[model samples]
Target: MRNVVLGVANTVAAIGFVLFASIVWSAALPLAIGLFLGSLLGPRIVRRAPQTALRRGIALAGLGLAVYLAVEAYG
Candidate 1:
């Protein structure tokens, strides 16, 4: 139920991003920024208390760093 809604919303967002990317000059930058923010914040919203928060924060930081490197390598 909730998962399905979230999945659908994410899919719609992805499609919207693709459509916008096709027409926008520098869409990748915004996409990257969005990814970074989502990675940094999403876990905090979903994770339980205590250790989960720490784990999620570390995971998000790693994701952000990886995205940054990938963008720099390709862009």
Candidate 2:
């Protein structure tokens, strides 16, 4: 739940930056669409996912994201 809020906040901020900065939409549109679709389907997925697996998956993804951000910021 908290991660969902953080993800949403990051998404909104990214969208704002993209819109205000006038970045190349063509370069990012596909990735954005895939992410949006994946998130949109999460409810259906959750219905099928086992509780423990879901928690592990989310934790793994969060760790991956943290590492990616750390490298992007300080690597």
- The C-alpha local distance difference test score for the whole of candidate 1 amounts to 0.85
Q: What would the TM-scores of all predictions be? A: 0.35, 0.57
Give the per-residue lDDT of model 1 (tens digit) for 1-75.
Answer: 999999899999989977775655387789889999999987886565577777888899999999999999999
CA lDDT, candidate 1, residue 35 = 92
lDDT of 2 at 37: 96
Q: How does candidate 2 score on lDDT?
A: 0.92
User: Candidate 1 clashing pairs?
Assistant: none
Clashes of each: 0, 0
Worst 10 residues of 2 by lDDT: 18-27
- Candidate 1 has a TM-score of 0.35
Show where candidate 1 strays beyond 4 Å: 1-49
- C-alpha root-mean-square deviation, each candidate: 10.4, 6.0
For residues 1-75, write the lDDT of model 2, one tens digit per residue: 999999899999998997788777787889889889988998899999999999999999999999999999999
